[model samples]
Target: MCPSKVAEGGQRGWIVPIGGAEDKENDKRVLRRFLELCGGDGAEIAVIPTASRLNETGDRYEQIFGGMGARNVHVLDFDTRRDAHERNRVARIEQASGIFITGGNQLRLSTILGGTPVAQAIRACNAHGIPVGGTSAGAGILSEHMIAGGDSETETPRANGVRLAPGLGLTNRVVIDQHFRQRDRLGRLLAALAYNPFAIGLGVDEDTAAFIGPDNVVEVEGSGAVTVVDADGLQFSSMAQVDGDSPVCMLGVQLHILTAGASYNLVTRKASAGELSTVKE
Candidate 1:
């Protein structure tokens, strides 16, 4: 296992990846959890709504977080890549206790924030143990390699069904898919794993979340489940071996379905059985 990234004398910040459509008005369990990890009523949060084109997207989260008792909340909005690269624009992120990214379009989030100073600042803050949370498209960009967009309802794994793109690179070895069961995204996520078998595939259902610790211990929370697809031991027909839009043939893939309170260790690739149980990879 890798050593914890928590700074000396400080608690390790969390990575909260939420599937879209979380209830902000009712229980607000997901957002509440984020606030708790971010330091409760004293939390300083940065809200990035760049994924959504709507003018009010950022405001909506600002209001939500404010009502949740965040001491300070700032919305970082950038109209262009030039604005995204401005150090002044992203300076607030460096001082924040946590950052929340809203849902809309993953491509917009990546194209605007990728390789920019703001993205760098986020990576730096996360390294220093600042919790970062995102929902829907926001959740998709938490990994180094992200599923940009895909055909959700496909029954088979098509070679070109899913689109891949560069993301925030917060987590190094997993690909995230949001609104998993709600949208029937299993096939799409499976296709992504087929293309990048070395990484674990996480399909998070709507209203659910996976809180990843600095040591890569992921604890599922909220109403739905998280589906973990491990393709490490899989035998598959190569993408190059097939022509046109044929389904990829795969074997020996391991799948685990986890609900709230269940945890998984990214380092050992094992699921915990109440007390950190170990499973064969």
Candidate 2:
């Protein structure tokens, strides 16, 4: 895993593929990792399940996180933001040492928090190394160029994924997508990279996560894996043909699959470049 240079005393973050509730084992492990990143007990943590299966999402989080040893887990119901609701949510983000986002429809998170006080608060918390993390949808929004949300089964370049209006640009020049293999999203990610070649593409698998540090190191953990598609140095054809909802032939692109015990360097935007556990593609 590509573990960043740990600060003397700072919180770390884990980007999971959809929050850890679905997988009991993964949830436990992620919770342990969160605890570790928070430096163990007394870590002020909050869980925002803003992205969930619509109805019954918030209460589900209390049940899951409460069982994970999180004593004071604050749930932010962004669906209907009252004045006091916004203030409390922003306050929690500002004071939080660790903020965890739940998995569901990322669009839900973006629509509510986009250009809002809470979005800024979330970004501020991440900037200070407060360890902002999420699974599935949460993981997808970490990149400056977020995938937002997209459709599947359509491999054409015409497929357009929503942008995070005002995403927390922790990692810039990159767009992230989750449920990679399980969902067959490589073509879509490639389409996104084709449209913006300068940006990187990361397709994370279920039950897997990428632990990133301030130093730009990303380590792969859990039973699943992460795919890194770097088109920055690729030799490709015109994106116009593909933009017409047609398939475009991509000539050269660097793709790497980083699984458990593997790591990647975000600064270099390459995998297996450091001493961390990693594999060359």
Candidate 3:
């Protein structure tokens, strides 16, 4: 549940990747910790099943909340334009203690829910100290600037390897990419940082998460690691010819890699030492 500062004082959120969920023991642990952050109260788990390909995703969501001791779980089916779906989603977000975006095509979620009334409601949750978390596509949409998806490991320097999509922007000046190590998405994340020095690029490995607290303190959790790319001080060549899919040469960038327990201040753009130390492994 983290400390009281995260649970009751300010905005806190978590980002996770798809197919990276831990076992029941770990899931229960995370849920407990997150609930504590929501003032030790049972969180209203809102599942956006919009991205899922099948109805079973809805069922899986029910199980998730049940395991977390959250009796209030709502699934929003964005595939339908029915007022009922939209109204229900809005109501759920307004009362939710936490929101979770399920794994699937993040682009689909954004396209369907981007400007909807429900989207605004979710933002309100962030404004309130309620922690919002996502796995896979859900994690991808937490940043103001989001990585829709891209080709990794090509090394072809092709443009459009990483597609930039409008995220929910619960947090500003950041872009998040998931399944980083499993997918080797450093290049794309770096490109994103190079393109926008004002933003920090976070690549979260599968089975891992970045738990960000109200003070803008970010902690790495799970078995994997978190990578932060800071290009704010780097000098880069022009991206004029890069277009959308072309890769541009990005040199002199600084990257900080941190494992679990390490923390970084997203606001100051500085990696912390001691309890928040950055380490290779």
Please list the Cα RMSD from the true structure of every candidate, rounded to 1 decimal place. Answer: 4.2, 4.9, 4.8
- lDDT by candidate, in order shown: 0.85, 0.66, 0.69
User: For each candidate, what TM-score against the reference?
Assistant: 0.91, 0.82, 0.84
| lDDT over C-alpha atoms for residue 239 of model 3 | 60
lDDT of 3 by residue, 1-281 (tens): 01222334455454333324543455554445555555443656777777778888867866767666676777767785443246655887788777777778888778777767777777766766667777778888777788877778753334566678788777775678887888788878876666667878787877777787766778777777788887777787446567776667876676788876777788898886545434457
Tens digit per residue, CA lDDT, model 2, 53-83:
6666656655665666665667766774343
Which pairs clash in the backbone of model 2?
A: 1-262, 2-219, 2-263, 17-136, 18-135, 18-136, 19-135, 262-277
C-alpha root-mean-square deviation, candidate 1: 4.2
lDDT of 1 by residue, 1-281 (tens): 12224467765467788999988898998889989999989999999999998999899998898998999889999778999878777888988999999999999989888888888888778878899999999999888888988788775777787888888888767889999989988878888888768889889999999899877888888899999988888886466576457887878788888887788888899986553244446
Candidate 2 Cα errors over 4 Å, as ranges:
1-22, 25-27, 53-55, 81-85, 154-166, 273-281
Model 3 lDDT, full chain set: 0.69
Instruction: Rank candidates, TM-score, best first.
Output: 1, 3, 2
The predicted structure with the larger lDDT, 1 or 3, is 1
Enumerate clash totals for all models, in the order shown. Answer: 0, 8, 14
